[model samples]
Target: MDAWEPRPVPSVTPETEPFWSAAADGRLLVRECPDCGLVYHYPSALCPDCFADAEWREASGAGTVYSFAVQRHLGYWPEDDLPVVFAYVELKEGPRMVTNVVGCRPEDVEVGIPVEARFVPTDEGGIGVPVFVPTEP
Candidate 1:
């Protein structure tokens, strides 16, 4: 069996380019809509609520764990490490994201646990992806 290796590169696409760019630069982004005052994640150009074009801006990086589940299988990405905790982190700005819970044990994750976005630098010490971890009070 091969040892699980963590991601050493950042993944950015047109739709989520802003987010990745910001995270790489030590900032967290949350979607905000000028059309209807709605904020969301897994960013969309159009507001999910008002269907208006949205904008990405820096977030407080402060949120709470709303829900979570421990993933035991890789499905397609078989190289994914086991006991991966998938969580819904609800930001104080009124948006939530489906992301992984890092910096702790999967079995220790709990609902309503405070969390914040923490960047994982790439192989060459460049900015990488944003992962969540338990936040301190």
Candidate 2:
């Protein structure tokens, strides 16, 4: 999707309502478990652990690239398309989130490469999507 274009976010069930609402404000929100201080994505209303209700809050979005790979051949991603930098960012607070690495060329990504959140406005139907771009050098 074009960074400048807003498209509808295809899914928004009752459970995920709060997440979309926060994203609309240009905030990157994550679920935090009060019981264990755990944070995660794929928004959930309840903490999987301790059955504690989840709290919605802003995320620092600062993290490091845990691991990645260069796709030698893939039709889904165009030949000239930006390289996909999939990462599992381990938050300083305790949650590790799965997300794509953007803003930098794929070759620049490496294990432990530091990154911070830069939210992009996106629409997945009616739900707002908070896509991340790497912090500028």
Candidate 3:
């Protein structure tokens, strides 16, 4: 395998810090609105629906593939030397997240496929990025 670097780490802001920290510990966290009980992604300080303060909650870490595409080539992802499955996963709790599907062939992925979250090390020190993999039937 070619010795290549991973993608640059994302800058964590105050609002997104908890999500990234939870992911590093092998858990996935999402924002939940205490007022309306709405779950959402891209963790924010306020709910998008009702403009209420959102609380951090642990997610089920299980989701379904809402949509997906395979990237056969990319400059930054040279370490894998294979097609990368980019997908939008709909979490069981409600919100959808943009993540990558791993631990299976790109051809095997499909819409509505069951997947569970996996944490992979990032270029960012002390951080693990969340990805999804196929779940058993």
Candidate 4:
């Protein structure tokens, strides 16, 4: 088995600095268009819906698993970290974002399962990466 490599840290740009800064504090943020009222992720300068400048808003950190895939083998991941669950989580605010489902076994995840956001700090202590875990019953 190969050594575990650290996950890539997201690059911070002028437009995304606030988003990353908030993430470092364990807060999840989404971009909202003041014009069209569209809320979305992957912070960008302009809204995809109306091209209007988007503003940052804190999210509720609650969501549901929309779809997922269990990876049993990936060259970059350590052997012990097998079966990573990658999923698309639909935030209660109404936008879908790609994220990972953690804190549980891969087989334990399924579509439509309620989830909540959890932040994992980067190895270098940079911005926290937002991931989801199943909500308690």
Candidate 5:
């Protein structure tokens, strides 16, 4: 089998460009509805809840693991990165993202573990990808 290459670089659209820009500057941003005060990811034109116009807001970068899975093998990635823990983290402000849990072992993760966001440069385009790591009490 062929070895894993780098993931595809994300193309920035008008709506998502702000997110990528903020991430490059080491900030995590989420779109928030002014009417309902609901924050969400994957930037959209209208609010998911009230359909009101939303604005970008800085996130606190702190969350708790909602769920996770330890990937022991990859068909398209490098084996050296085995045991990658993929998690759904519920942000303190009110959004959940499917992000990788890094800087720790997969065996150590739990459903409610506290995590803090971190940005890492992507292999494809040097774009900042938001990841999470275990938070120290």
Candidate 6:
């Protein structure tokens, strides 16, 4: 298998700082609205549904693959990392997030497969980024 290329470091803004901080400690977080009980990713100060204040909550880190695509070519990425599996994982807490599915061959990933979150730290002591891997059977 080809080794993955280095991931781009994500920019941490005030809205997403907490989420990244939790990830660095090997934890996943989601924003939930107390009023309507709506859970969401991509940290925000208010809920998308009712515009209520959203609070940060730890996620289960367990999810299922909702959808995916295999990238065979990209001008910037090296050939060794050509076949990266990008997926949307539906979390147990009820929101889907876009992330990479790693730790296995790209061809092996499929919809509905069970997966769990893992954190990969970025270069220069940047925050950890969440990725998924197939759960052990």
Ordered from best to worst lDDT, the candidate numbers read 6, 3, 4, 5, 1, 2
Clash pairs (backbone) in predicted model 2:
7-123, 8-123, 8-124, 8-125, 9-123, 9-124, 9-125, 10-124
Off by over 4 Å in 6: 1-5
Best by TM-score: 3
RMSD (CA, Å), each prediction? 4.0, 3.4, 2.4, 3.1, 3.7, 2.5
| Residue pairs with backbone atoms closer than 3 Å in model 3 (clashes) | none
TM-score of each: 0.80, 0.74, 0.92, 0.90, 0.88, 0.91
- Output the worst ten-in-a-row residue range by lDDT, candidate 1: 1-10
The C-alpha lDDT values of all candidates are 0.76, 0.65, 0.86, 0.84, 0.82, 0.87
lDDT of 5: 0.82
Instruction: State how far residue 106 of model 1 sits from its true place (Å).
Output: 1.7
> Worst ten-residue run, lDDT, model 2?
1-10
Q: What TM-score should be assigned to candidate 1? A: 0.80
TM-score for candidate 4, residues paired by index:
0.90
lDDT of 2: 0.65
lDDT of 6 at 10: 76
Q: Put down candidate 3 lDDT per residue, 32-126, tens digits, no spaces.
A: 99999998998898999999999999999999999999999888775455688999999999889999898898989999999999887666655
Shift of residue 69 alpha carbon in model 4, Å: 0.5
Q: For candidate 1, give the lDDT.
A: 0.76
Candidate 4: where is the Cα deviation over 4 Å? 1-5
Model 6 lDDT tens row, 1-137: 22122646678998898888888778999999999999999898999999999999999999999999999887765666668889999999989999999889987899999999998775535477899999965
Candidate achieving the largest lDDT:
6
Clashes of each: 0, 8, 0, 0, 0, 0
